[model samples]
Target: MLRVVRIAGPATLVGVGFAALLVALAIGGGAAPQLLEDPGAVVRFGLPTSTMLVNLAASGMIGALGLVLFAIPPASAAYGRALDVAAGSAAVFTVAAAFTGFFSYLSVTARALSFDDTFSQGLGQFLTQIALGQAWLQTTLIGAVVTVLCFAVRNQTALFFVGLLAVASLIPMAQQGHAAGTTGHDAAITALGLHLIFAAAWLGGLAVIALISRQIETPKLVDIVTRYSSVALICFIVVAASGYVSAELRIGSLDRLLTPYGLLVLVKVGALIALGVFGALHRRFVIKKLGDTGRRRHFWWLIVAELAFMGIASGFAAALARTATPVPETVPATQTAAEILTGSPLPPELTTANFLTQWNFDLIWILVCGFGIVFYLMGVLRLRRRGDRWPWYRTVLWIAGLLMLFYVTNGGLNVYEKYLFSMHMFGHMTLSMAVPLLLVPAGPVTLALRAIRKRDDGTRGMREWILLAVHSRAATVIANPIVAGVLFATSLVAFYYTPLFRWATEDHIGHEWMIVHFLIVGYLFVQALIGIDPVPYKLPYPFRLLLLLATMAFHAFFGLALMSGTGLLLADWFGATGRDWGVSAIEDQQAGGGIAWSIGEIPTFILALVVAIQWSRSDKKETKRRDRNADRTGEAELGEYNAMLEKLAARDGR
Candidate 1:
């Protein structure tokens, strides 16, 4: 366990350190510019021109190294050698790009002097630098192709397919950089590049470990897997830390979170937490019984669920890379002074707070209607559980209480525009955090099963329908990670950036969508995490960690981009107030983005650590169990036949 912990520690440290550095850069990098009287002009003309060239070179090299690593084959002993080369190259290039981008940003902004001139100059310089960086990135992609060629030379089919998918994924990366027309493309590029490499390490390492475990014919296999497990754990930590930093930098404002970008971040975070829980459960329950026949199905199910979530996370990441970051509304110092003298009036829309105020009236209606129906259901359940005289009133009251709780939690309706940052945060907490915990214990599946059993004799159609609904492929797919992640993340993106966010703010229709989307996304995210339901795919632990990391990175970048953006993407909606509250629009945008990127990491890192610890403990416990069983047998060579008889007898006794 100590050795396992040691192995995982460094990788996590490296990842966390890197993430911290990135976050620092995003937040502090703009401080100088914000303090200037004419920050825009300073950024445009005051900064130097050479920094762009350096950044371009650095981005190119890092991208190239990533490509090369992806191209190498797992079957070859040379695989590690190739990866070393790629890592070395990427390190060199990333350092160069980071310095170059930093210097260029500083020079162009001139610490926020000569605002107007700097703005134009800085924009041009930044663009040029990005173009160069893209060039390097493209070259790195070519190197990846070369690595794929090497895999082909070795006739490695698995490596080839992995390479192919890696290559295909690059399309979204390339498109996203330019598609949004946002100036934060450099940061986005860096985030995406790092994310890909880290993901590969995590997932690839897990694959290696799993393969090694399966091939273990002797005690040596245990040591080999233990070593590999350590590596995988470290990789997982890196993925989580890096992802957190990136998301914090992308989200620009609290208001923009209601937009697609914010919602997606929430969904991703939820999914990650869910995945961690599943990993813990698997390590605790399944690992100890690895060789037991009765537990094989459960083990397989857990694995499948993990993998399915990983795939879903991967797809969501792809979508995230393309989504636009939100820009915060700038409240200038001059405007702040004016607002002090003349206070602003609240908007006429019925906000979330308003809905809370009408709670009593809503509750009365819910109690009357909800209790009436619940009473009927209780009478039915009681009839089945006990013949006729079973405390039916008590059961009815219990049902009514449950409905009251549900109504109180979800009955509130709020207009989108009226939602303040605090309220929005509260809503997200309820959906992503509170709701998941409640639903998990509710055991919807178990409840449905019980209900069906009770109703089956008299209500054959209802039983068959319930069974079919649960058994259907469509239901299976909906419960799958891919569908869940996509639905959750996509809802966030679609609702926020498009007219949907504003519409939801304007009418009751939008509120309904928000509620539905949250519930669905929440359900999916939790299900993916706990893995109580059947999942069609199974990802190894390392792979799940990698996917989680990648998803977070995408989110961070999204937030950072929003924080750093010069113009408001949602200007028409947010700009109407003309209230620049002492900060530049871009600065506020960056701050909000940073918030999203940074906050999500705490839970993510904790989850990763828990997974590693759990896995290590399980491995040790299983080894000890096997040893004890061997000792108990006392030199008697037990064949499969004898083992089966002993297992049956033990079960009968239990």
Candidate 2:
């Protein structure tokens, strides 16, 4: 029994807990109130919502358990294998749980009875409800199976399968609340989902590493921890950003951040910061001092403590997910259609002339900023003589280009309005096209190095600081492929699916987040595609090409989905007004999605072709150099010529 407990403990505990919750909900007849018009019935049951809360809590607990189990070090080789099996089984169970809960919610809500009458429904209806909930439960189960299978396998090929399964599972889960109409609801849900996945990866990976540290020698432990630090930093950023977006959307007002949900979120954020601090300690002190006597146990304790807090935070997250969204009183029922189009409401006179006048001031400033950066960069380039090294000037030019790109993409117009397809198009181009192309060539790390080199190198203090910043673990992490890809992909997923898009159009705060997202995503995608700086782990050219192709295909599919969508997924925010742009709402939306699909391909294809050409050229040059070296005279008359050739080869490599 003790052995079984250790082998199947996490899965058994989570499964039994989830099953008990479901049984309790069914026995108490709590399913009916969710379908009611009044919210009071759910409150009466001490649940902020109906059985949805119970289901969500169960799912959260299962997810948390999976995370914990994944973190724990297997006691032995057999235990490790059993843990893998248990994880797979638990994932399968989760899928069933999701499906059943979904069906239950659907069946309970489909009944015509009010909130009071629904809870009073007979047992047969409840059981029928359980059948419908199978969809998501199955999906979750499949995802778990895939994750466990990934661990069981040792090949890179398995990663692709795991990635595919993960993406498949998230699709239905993300779409579940699509009908909620509230922009905040969509944003919060999407952000929360992303946060959960990222958290799982970070916490679970850390647990694995911690367990490994105990078993491996000090040197191997240091290497593993060092490698993982970069991943953790990226995850930290994702958690913070997503958490903030979710909190802002759910609270809907600055004042409500002090409320229960907000305070809880703050606590989670605090916990994350604490985790970061511990991570820093691991990097700065623990890992370096691993060879020291008696430090190994302390490191293990720190990791365990961090994992426990992460688990608690996950639970609080479950609670927070069920909390009532604070509705702001000052929000308008329907904003002026003109406001949606032009980004601001029309003047009191309400004439076309008045509308134009009101927006002119804002538009002029936007144009000034946009055009100013472009021309300034052009001027800087013109000033530099051909073949003269002006790395700093080039850096400034790229920075200027980025600023202008931001202005056009995010600053020029209202992103949330229905009819602002042109503005959205402009922003998308900057993010997916212009910015990536420009920044890729600029090479941020190389430029930073040049800038640091130009500083006072003679001063030991300043030089040390510069070296520290450039060679830091933080720098290395940002430059990792996995870290960069996750950040890039998550940004796109968060933007399209969440209320973040809608909220940005509704308020100033949302617009700022949009700008930040565009910049970060744009930077990551560019760095992935054509970075010149040192990346810790670089994918093979073929793999990079495949990743690029896959990303493009996904974007194109999303665009097609948007274009073909019968009902408005985002119509409320992006629809057009008659006075501006002259396009109908559906036409504008379809056009935007179509452009997103069609225009995206050009840059991708161009980049792929460029990479192929460069690779081929490099291969040819390498072959020629190898043949030349083979025929060279040994340490005689050709010494000077060989040195010259070596220098040229190095230049070519750069």
Candidate 3:
């Protein structure tokens, strides 16, 4: 059975994956009529086929590395084998992505490649200059880098960065899916990006397990299966949720499932369901008996089936990319400037009611908020079950903070942010300041530390990871009092004054980076000051208060500079939005400055007050500890001090 699994498992996976791709292409109309008439059968069918290969290879490369990082012990032979697989797979991805990019050009423009200088110049321009072509090029370059790193690098922690680079290679894939100027463009990018990443993790992890089955002994197999199962569960939920969002955006309605694109989607979904069922069965029954040869046979059979299903899912996905969505991914040729810039119709007049009513569900943020609330509640429950009391106030504060962040990201602030500078600033303040204020006092790290059971089996669990992060050299530097203060103060100015403001405003990837940056910088500053989470050190109250005031002054000066300045930041974005409902763009800029100048101070004041309260409480706790010690020993240390002083005086008198 072991020999059969070893020879057939990988072969079955590759064969099935390619076979499924061919079938989905036929179903999804890889033969469909094109807007252009010049490109022939090879370019049409070959483009998606190559793309399927890219996806396949990328999953194998990324999933193998990630599993090694997260589940397998770094010192094992399995780890080195995983890296070898990643290196081999990434090399394949590099080649495939380069071809895929060239094919994309052929498909989109219906042009044949030539070796002329004109053709060479155009190809270079497309690769380096055009968004769609640039994405594939980036993917190729990233894959090449991963290929080399997988072979060259062996350090475990450094490999985590390699894993991250592998994950980021998909960002361009997500971006090119929905071209710029499409309605729901940001949401589509977010959804598809997440879908690609988690799907790869899920698909690749299983493939790695099949690849490594022969090398793993029974005891290690049991442990590996259990750990990978947990990762698989997380991947399942994310893939399911992101798939739904992408489907809803593209499919639009259940009736549309009858269409070619929808039919391809259904094929993918069916495969996903089968995969989920197989995974559940493996976890529920098969994994418990890995040591038994009979159950091991069953497990390998399940692995084969799971790999086939993954192939189906991956193949259908590639085909779907080539298929036209029921609704075109891009808007019609005619569009308002606002639509072109912001990817949606100019928002209706900004009203108080509209702020609360408007929504742009950034899927990444929704997942963040959702996971945060769920995990927090779980921690609270864990504490409660053990007859331990966690402060209700802390939970409320945490929820409130996350909800505030949700509203700022998805609510009215987000709705108007792209159109009005004032709204953008308002949302920024909430995310960077108000939200952190509410959340910092919640002491999330403390709760996680107490609630999560420690793992002593040499497996780094979530709690251990959190602890390592808190005390890591990187965290130590970032969380330093001066560094945190400087980052908190300077990020606002640096972002606006630099190209970052333009990038964040226009690109989904940059927008997400902005959100994370603001939140972390805010959290770090608060963490340094009033944060109850364990840190290397918290400053004395006086020093903390001084730091707060100094940053406040810097923030005020920045806001004042904005208010007093005659210039507008990101003139092309804010200045060109062509809004009619709001005060002119210049006035909106001034309003943003006012919000920054005033609203930021409110959060600073709150930080100061929290610091003062914590300081007073610290004094009270110290005094109580001293009095309790005195009572315990009848003030023996104080009496000893008094006797020593008297002995000194007596010696002087003699």
Candidate 4:
């Protein structure tokens, strides 16, 4: 029965997915013949089909690697089989991406097929010169690289890097499709990107289990399934959240639910909800029953049922991409200066009320902050249940840090940062200084090292990976007090003086990278000074104080330079926002500099004070240790010292 399922399960998924895509295309007119300049029915139908294949292939590659890295033991036969599955999937992905790219060119150019140089030349230009073409081309090349690496690399650590590359291949695809040129283009891209990655991980994992089921015993299978269930739970949450954001952007209103495109979204949503319900059942009941010989067959059949729903969701998703949105995603007939520059209209005036109330939620940060808080609480709960004490204040501090980060990334600061330099600087200050001050002392890494169960199955789980990263050679260098301090202080000058500041302001990906860069550097520097987490080296308290003071001075210098400068940074962006209200552009820039100098120093003061307290406590502890030693030794060291003094005095008398 298991063998039959191993073969029939994936077949059912592909069949169901293909069927759903056809039905959705028919209903939404996604594959309909164009009124003019049609790329032929072949290109129209073939493009969606091939694109769906690309998605399925991508799922298999990522899912298998995820299981190998976290779930399956390296010595097990199933692990190698899973890698084989990933390799095979990558090959399929490569071919499918190539076809998708070619079909895309045909659709766009509406050019007839030919055997001449003109045809070859146009196709080459499309692949090399055009944005859509370049995206697909990059996908194909990445797929090819991943394919080779999966076959050649067997080390668990190496495969982790390969998995990252596989995931990155999806970025270009996420940026295009329904996300490009949308009103909330950045949000849409972030939403769609999260949706694709998590959905692939969820669906692809189950498929991998089916493919490698024969290599595992029931006992081991139960463990793997349990681990997979945890991952799927996370994937489900992210997928649902991102899907909501994507659907909201495309549909715009509840009334649009009756439209064809909206109905297709509803279909996909239903399928996802059903999959989620099935996963819950597995976690609650079926997983436990799988260890029973009599119930094992029944459990595998349920797996097949879950895969069918996944297929339905996947199919409808691909079709929806090709379908037109109910709300037009195009630019307006007339544009405001704010719209022209930031791709959105100028927000309401920046009153205290508006600043506190207005929000532009970044989907990525929302997930990051949400998961961070939940997982930290869970770790604390685990420690308490085990009769191990974790500080309540640490929990509070961690939660506070995440909340501040959430506000900086998703609140009013995010909304106006593109238009106003002061807002951007305010956010940068909070991200680099305030957030780290709260987060570093929380000792999240210490908690995780204590709370998470140690896995000895030759497979690296989250705890193991965290440990490896902490002790890695690269980590040793960068986490050094001096290096971290230098990076923390110099980044301010380097970023603003270079092209990075402009890139961060103008590009969505760049902006996200900028936030991450600042946050990481700040955390490292603070950790070097007063962090509770384990590190390779720590300076004495006095040097730590000196380092903090030095960094503080450098930060002030940078801020002063900006304040005194006649020229504005990214004048094109800040100066061009065309705001008639609030401060002028140069004044706003100066205010930002003032923020950097003054508001950013608040965290430095807190850090220095904390260091002093720790230093005083260390001295008291050392003194207590000496007192205890004196009592243990009964003044023998004092007697030896007196005898030496007596011998010296007798020699002087002679």
Question: How does model 4 fare in lDDT?
Answer: 0.92
Residue 148 displacement in candidate 2 (angstroms): 7.2
| Comparison by TM-score, 2 against 3, better one | 3
Ranking by TM-score: 4, 3, 2, 1
Per-residue alpha-carbon lDDT of model 4 for 1-654, expressed as tens digits? 678887888998999999999999998888999999999999989989999999999999999999999999999999999999999999999999999999999999999889899999999999999999999999999999999999999998899999999999899899886857647989998998999899999999999999998898888899899999999999999999999999999999999999999999999889988998999999998988886653578778988999999989888888898898998987788888888888888999899999999999999999999999999999999999999999899999999999999999999999889888989999998999999999999999999999999987777889999999999999999999999999999999889989998888888889999999999999999999999899999999999999999999999988898788779888888999879899899998999889999997889889999999999999999989878877899867777899999999999999
Using lDDT as the measure, which candidate wins?
4
lDDT of 1 by residue, 424-534 (tens): 433543554345534443344543444543321111233444565667687778876556655645565566578877765443334445655676675665455443434
Local error of candidate 2 at residue 354 (angstroms): 14
Model 1 has an lDDT value of 0.45
Model 3: number of backbone collisions = 0
lDDT of each: 0.45, 0.53, 0.86, 0.92
The model with the greater TM-score, 3 or 4, is 4
Could you report the Cα RMSD, in angstroms, for every candidate shown? Answer: 24.2, 14.1, 2.2, 1.6
Error of 4 at 12 (Å): 1.0
lDDT of 2 by residue, 1-654 (tens): 322333332333234334433333343343325544433443433331322332333333333233223222233342254335334534544554444453345444543334575454643354444433444555556656655664564332333345445544543444343213354433544565556556655665554453333345555455446556655776776777677766666676888777755666676787788888988887788767774653466666666666656654554554453444565423357875764444345334333453333321122223334544554445445445333355574566477665655445433233333245544754665665666676666664553443332323121222334455556687578656666666655666677778877776554336546765676666766666666765556766777787778777877777787688656546655543534534666666677778778887787887788678767887899888877775775545367778899999999999
What tens digits encode model 3's per-residue C-alpha lDDT throughout 166-271?
Answer: 9999998988884345788888888888989988888888888788766777777788888889888888888999888888888889999999989998888898
